[model samples]
Target: MAYCRCLTPAANQMLVLVSRQSPPYCSIRTMFVSTRRPHKALLKTLHASRRRPSVIRWQSQSAPKKRLLNITPQSLLVAALITGMVAAVYIWLEWKKFVHQAGGRIAALSDSGIGTLNWTLTDQNGKRREYAEFRGQWLILYFGFTHCPDICPEELEKLVEVVEGIDGNPSTPDIQPIFITLDPGRDTVEYMHKYCKDFSPKLIGFTGTTEEIDTVAKSFKTYYSLGEKDEDGDYIVDHTILMYLINPDGKIVDVYDKSAKADGIIRGSIKHISEHEKLRRKTFLPF
Candidate 1:
């Protein structure tokens, strides 16, 4: 066995060193020293750790992210339904405007005859009558002669239907259907009397002198001319196929063409007269 020993220097004494040699036997010696130094690899690792968090924060801020939720089939269906509803509403509004404009145009183009008139004439019964007698009622004044072959009869039939239609309705205003003879010379008072009886009982025929008929026709702006004589030495009268709608005050408010059916005549006349009466009542004050 081998042994080792330690020695300490005394105060104010010189330092001394000593060594010992041992025999050729197994022995071991050891010495220990400590020094202060910085760890470079540890500092580099700490810096990398701090920079990694900053890099991750920047990437998260710069990247694009979806804000809304994912779209579904239900959402798509809702979108399509809304679009269809909007389109339907737009189409309906356009169609309504188009119809309104078309009706206005038609009303504007239809016949509108001359205004009011005052006259005196002879009835089919040879009784004298004044135009003022027909006041406070609607009047359908037609100018034609019994000598007319086609137009007169056709017009007379239409007038008969119109008269029946108005008389059939309880709500419509009372109206007088008048047939003034354009051929006063040929359509004698007796002939007109018989002719009126053939048509509706409500029809009234008027006849008078040539000058009187001419005056009345001019007042209404009616067009009538003698046509060529037929094979039997009989002449026909060509006249306008106008049906005049006269108001209660003997004023020609409107005129309808021959194309107007009985139903249309009744409906349009009633509508216009009712509306006009309502307006007049609202605005007029009894004196």
Candidate 2:
């Protein structure tokens, strides 16, 4: 009886082990486990992982992107290049227009029948003179002020060289060089007299009232403007730098810009004035 009892227990243990190992019994156990312990913990873990914000990663990526957008060297270079090109084109266009307009005006003056300009004004010595007084001679007229910093001196030097060259040539027509002060207010007769003496003994200086100066400037089509007042209420005058070549008939035969060399000016003035004189001699004779 003891042996049978022991055998019965052993048989039950074997039966339980077999049932746990068998597929059908294992499936029934798995079903019981799935139902009793819902996979709630696993599902919740997965949901939390999905809901977790990737805020740190996104912020790190955005910092580099923002830096790239804000600090781009190529953008600055492109902007500067565009600005430089625009400025260059504008300057070129302006220069072209100035040259074209200046050329057209010169052509019109050459064709116009304005003859010559005539006027009378006081010299630096306070002596009255007339443009007619310089008749039968070529006059090289330069309009400027004493206060001019650079251009006036340069033009005056060129004029001196040109007059000297003409005087050297016996065949060349006589050229009476004249210096007219656009700033008569500052350049008094006494100042002009001394200034003229310094330049050349033959250089005649002229000054007049502001109104008279304006009239003369207008007749020559010269432009001038007053600069800003200084600390002492003094101002500068900016005037045209053109040199006018007048024939013996006192007509504005030609105009020379500041670029015309001294030699060229002398040659051109002598040739033009001599031609006019020859023509005049033919027209009027004392035979």
State which candidate has the highest TM-score: 1
- Please write out the lDDT profile of model 2 over residues 107-201, one tens digit for every residue: 46756743345677899889998878988787889999987888898898899888898888887766889999899899999999888888899
lDDT of each: 0.72, 0.73
Clashing pairs in 1: none
- lDDT per residue for candidate 1 within 125-226, as digits (tens), equals 999999998888888978899877787888888888887788778877678899999899898889999999888788899999999998889888888888
Q: Give the TM-score of candidate 2.
A: 0.58
lDDT against true structure, model 1: 0.72
Candidate 2: where is the Cα deviation over 4 Å? 1-117, 281-287
Which lDDT value does model 2 have at 116? 42
In angstroms, how far off is 48's CA in candidate 1?
Answer: 32
Reference-based TM-score of each model: 0.59, 0.58
